[model samples]
Target: MESLANLECFVRSAETGSFSAAARLLALTPAAVSRNVAMLERNLGVRLFQRSTRKLSLTETGEHFLASIGGNLHALQAAIGAVTTERGEPAGVLRVSLSPSFGIGQILPLMPQWLARYPLIRPDWQFENRPVDLIAEGFDAAIGGGFALTPGVVSRTLAPAHLIAVASPAYLAGRPLPRQPEDLAGLDNIVLRASRTGRVRQTVLRNAAGLESAVQLNESMIFNDPVAMREAALLGLGVALLVVPDALPWLERGELVRLLPDWYVDLGVISLYYPSRTLMPAKTRAFIDFITEHFEREALARRFRAGPG
Candidate 1:
């Protein structure tokens, strides 16, 4: 039988599309990954990859080989997990990636409880506004909002993300409140542009008269950070479309007010995403369960229901 180490290297290289990338992910050298793949190919008596100066492509044999072993490999991983769970407490490094704002406002504050509960687990956390390549980056899990997930990762919703249009009371004080969405054309709008795709600035609004219209505003300020957008809106720079959780403190403090509350967009759901559970490390599984339980039992649930305390 081919060594499991060689099989693992081959599978990782195929999934990531490069020997160097697979090596980095596996904490092995490029030569080591290449040697393992070559060894596996020799053992199987078939070429696994078409090597080139520029790129790598799987051979027909390699494709069939992967299909044949994938299910068995997943089952083997699951069996290992079942054995480990039945034995004792989980232990290992749990690597996590999350969006900056949510990481700061939501997850970080609650981490102390998680740490206390799982003394055997150590966590390595990264925060960014961009999506993480979980397998490539060696992260066990990611917390994110917006954007469709890449294939090969599993995702579960943690909360519903509600985007609201908000501006400071001073900005709207004596001005005719945008009774209809079309009236926003005359208002200054703040745009959050985290991704290159830019932010959505159009909104649909219904007036008290039950008349509905679409409003598209020209942005007066474009910011990549949600916190900065909130500050600009507070300074009366313009109106902003903000996620409710991030805007809650300002709204409660009377620094900002929601506009067109009835008509707003639903950004992608907030989720806790991870690689397939079958290969998940014990520490990762524990962290996932902890986060899931904490959100349900803590202030997060209430905040989502009653609009940020």
Candidate 2:
């Protein structure tokens, strides 16, 4: 508990950039904050902050230590809250970030029941194609693909990020059908350019037999957002390689047809990401458990696994 107090003081000092500011935030005296930090430095045998007349800032070691233990401090606080509260009925605004199509198509549908189950929990969600800084943005959780596992962030696999080629029947009316992976060259293609890299990415398609082949589309059209790319394909513009979960509704209704039915690309895993805390907030933990259980009950992960149908 003493060590925990020292850590809490250090984290607060690091965040606010001074012992006085940390003292104000933690409701302690500036001298006490300084003493706690000094004790921590002695125990760890490393100077955490470089002190100056104008300001104080974390040393290189201090920066790394903060990144590593920041989440655990939060978890410790949350655990204390969980046990201390009288009812502890998970009351809070549950802020989440996720992709548009999947959030709308898959996650959005699950919300009504979830809300009913935990009415005290208010939903605050953002839908985007690109990743956001989960901690900096003050998000409780995020769901998507290709997010770097930075310090204090953890993820649980929700579903496979599988990409399959699709086009409206009108677009392929007179165009050559893609019988093989290479046959996509003969058809009009809608490419997805990485917003960060500004490069049209290549996709590796795999079949049931475990054979893999990479395909590069000749860009008849390019889109930065996955939802827009799928919409373009649905508008009869061209064949677009889209994640299966995003296209499931359209595919099920016969509005979009899968080109090369036996082939799909392994983009990665669609995951639920949250802070890697020693103990999570009740609201965040509840949401995580609910979503995980829902995914299992529906077998959505198995349905979305990469490769042949």
Candidate 3:
């Protein structure tokens, strides 16, 4: 068990590239994680990490050992979780990745109730707008849309991750509304720089009747996050494209109005993504089931429909 502890510390540190990051994931102090890995090095009579101020890199032995054991770590965790939760109650840290706009606006609100219901499971969620390498980064689950489902990972649809052009009433006080996708070429677009690629992503607009068109938007301002884009539109800076879920509140409050009521960018469904079902940890499984049920009960997916946009 002591060897197991050391291996866990070493593996997490390797995956995260630094002791501090591993500590956050493990819910331990950086010093404690560093000490554990050092102890393991002493026991094995070899340095596992080549440490420097900027980052931690794996030594040869560390790389070999990690390759040998990393694949089995989940199985070991699942076995322990099975015993710890033999009574059918899920317990353990449940780490998840989420985008801030939806995480803060929608999911965060339901967390109190979720925590109450699953008192044993600890939520360690990361709020970010970029795509995450779930298996490599050791995230239990992630939420978003348009991510390619790699082998050994799976997803469950939550709601449409559709995008539509919007502008504040003040911004469009006298401006002609865009009646078609191509009309958007004439409006000033607040665009998003893709987090993963560092490029402006192409927007494909779809109509209610399923017709599609691409737009080469005229950029007025550019943002890296959806929240910022939403704010720009709200401030009457320019027309911005936003996901339905993120823009729902503003639409309801009449702070922003959707343009081209029939056109939307089908970015695909936002989903709860996780590792394979086989050998899944109890905490993750519990979260998946809980979130699914919550969505159904609240009819949350329908709310993302947001009256055409």
Candidate 4:
């Protein structure tokens, strides 16, 4: 029989394509992970991976082995998790991925309250802009919008990912506010270039009346990140399209004014994503419940909607 630790080391190393990355996730030294993997390989009597200074590639046998054992390992973990949950408090390193702007502005504020409820759980969160591979990257959960639904993962939508046009009050002063999407062409537009596509995004604004219009803007400034766009708009550089949560605070503070308030671009829903296991880790379940409860109690879905304002 193979040790579970050896199997874990092999699987994590394969997933991350590096021993150092596997070590980080397992909270073990790289040398320890390497030795465990070596032990597993010795037991199997086969070369599992082809190692190099720059990369690690799986052998054909290793690929077959990984595919065969992956689901079984997860099932075993689920069984263990079920027993562990029944015995004690929800506690562990809760690894999560979050979008930089939204996470800091909205979810970060709730951490103190959440920690009070589950003090045993240690938070390990990565603030990133791009969508992450939940299983491959060993993320327990991820909070963001525009993530593709991969196998074995499910999402719970927290709010609408609607983007509304905004401009600093200083920039809007003495300028005619946009009453329609087409009117935006006259203003200095701070636009986002899609990070994956490397192309400027075309804005199509829709109103409550189901009226939709393709917006033509001056495109005076371009950014690859929403956070940068928000900051540029705050500095009175130009009009920017921002998600409701990102712009809400500035709008409330009178620093930024919503342009074409009745119109917004719907990208998708901001969602909480986690692996769809038969029995989820207790820490992950607790964190998901905490966030969902907070969103429901605050009516954030309604507030994040940009249809009326």
Candidate 5:
């Protein structure tokens, strides 16, 4: 039988697409991860990956193998969790991955309460804009926007957020305010590089006639951070699109004016995602419940609602 260690190595390597990354996550060298995967392949009598200088692709046999064993692996983990829960208190390291903005706005504020409630459970947090591989990265949970939950991980919606376009009143004072979506084609824009996917930021704008046009923005003063972009927009640099939760305060204070009130992009729900709860560690379960309860409370929920424009 293949060893559990080798099986884990295979899964990690597959999920990360890099031997070096998987090695770092597992606290081992790349050569060690490669060896474990090789041993597993030998035991199974089939190659699992096609490797090149630039990329790693799974073999057909490897895909089938993963599909066949994935459920069993999760079940084994769940069994171990059940035993641990029955014995005593839950105490272990829980890793969480989240975007920097959400981390700053939501999760960080409530972390102290979580720490006080579960003093025995330690947490490792990583904040970034990139997509994370939960299983390969060894993360217990992640908070993020959008609905693109990867296969094998489960996701639960925590809240809803919308994207809005805004600019400073001084910037719009002399310039002809856009009456139609196409009018923005020639205007200066403050684009966020971190939020752009591929070559453009996909935006939908509504004209006075209530007609919506899908605009692909490729030109702008691009910034890597949202806060910086919003600051620049506040200084009359240009129009910018930001999430309602992040831009509402500026709008209420009259530092920024909503450019297009009738049109906005629905970024869908912000969610807390994790591996199956059947095998979830006690610390992770507690944190998830705490966050869910916090958002459900009337006072806290009101704080998230879009304020006066």
Candidate 6:
């Protein structure tokens, strides 16, 4: 039988698509991980990975082998972790993906408290703009909006992605303050072009009364990023529809003012996604509980709702 270490090296390498990343996770040198995988393939008398300088891909046989053994390996790790965790706190490298703006502004602030409770657990977090595949990419969890519910992945909603119109006081100095959604048409509008679709994002404003109205945003400046739009608005460029989280700090600091506060657009829910496995890692479970508890206690979901203050 091949050694468990070799199998682990192969599996992690496949998931990360690189020996270096797997090495970081396993605390092994890249050369050692490569050697272990090579040894495993030689023992099996078949090629597993189509190795190259730029990328590594699995062959047909490798794919089948991974499917057969991946679950079993995870179960074995979970069993070991369960036994170990009985002696002390959950400890390991916890790999998680997060949206850049939200993670930095909201979640990162909670880390000090989290670390105080679980000092042994180490966090390896990546701030990304795009949705990540939790299982295939080997992420323990991901926090973002609009991620598709792929097979073997489950999500817990954190907040409604409510969008509200905002502009700097400088921008609104001369222009009339918008009393309603339609009043925004006369002002210069800074807009976001959808990064994935390459088209301008459309907004339909809705209020507490269940009434919806469309606003015609005259694009004076266009951006493919929310941060850029916020900055443009701060520079007195134009009115921009911004997600509540993105607008909250500026709104609180009085750097930007919310317009037509009674109205908002519900884009979707920001969610926390994780693999739907039978035996999840102890570290992951602890992290999830900690984050969800924090959200509830802080009433962040309700705070994220855009309404009259």
Best by lDDT: 4
How do all the candidates rank in terms of lDDT, highest first? 4, 6, 2, 3, 1, 5
Model 2's alpha-carbon lDDT is 0.82
**Between 1 and 6, whose lDDT is larger?**
6
TM-score, per-candidate, Cα-based? 0.69, 0.75, 0.73, 0.77, 0.66, 0.75
- Please write out the lDDT profile of model 5 over residues 82-138, one tens digit for every residue: 333444656567678888877876678877887887766788899887767665455
| Candidate 4 per-residue lDDT over residues 110-185, each given as its tens digit | 9899889888889999998899877555678999987877655799999899999999989988998887799999
The positional error of residue 211 in candidate 4, measured at the CA in angstroms, is 1.6
How do the residues 1-309 of candidate 3 rate in per-residue lDDT, one tens digit apiece? 333446677899999998889877765567767887988888788998998888799989899989998999977765754534557778778789998998888889889888897888889999988777665456788987766676456889988777878899999998988777888888889999998889998988877666789899998788999899999898999999998878888898999998988778877788999866445667777788888898899787877763354
Going through the candidates in order, what is the number of backbone clashes in each?
0, 0, 0, 0, 0, 0
- Give me the overall lDDT of model 3: 0.81
Tens digits of per-residue lDDT, candidate 1, 1-309, equal 454446777888888999999887766667767887887887778999999998988999889988887667756555444333344777666789988887898789877888787766677889888887665455778998653465446888877676677899889988877754666678998876756566554565443344556666787887888888888899988888777788888888988988765555555478898866435566778888988987888656456532322
Clashing pairs in 1: none
lDDT of each structure? 0.74, 0.82, 0.81, 0.86, 0.72, 0.84
- Candidate 5 residue pairs in clash (backbone atoms < 3 Å): none
Best by TM-score: 4
Question: How would you encode candidate 2's per-residue C-alpha lDDT over 135-210 as one tens digit per residue?
Answer: 5455789999888776557889988888899999998897778789988877788888898899888877888998
The candidate with the higher TM-score, 3 or 4, is: 4
Worst 10 residues of 6 by lDDT: 77-86
TM-score of 6: 0.75
Tens-digit lDDT track for model 6 on 1-309?
A: 454457888999999999999978876668767888998998999999999899999999999999998878876655644423456688777889987778887899989999998888899999877897665456789998888786557999988889999999988897779898888888899888887789898879999988999887788889887888898899988899988988898899999999998899988898999876555667888988998998899888999988542
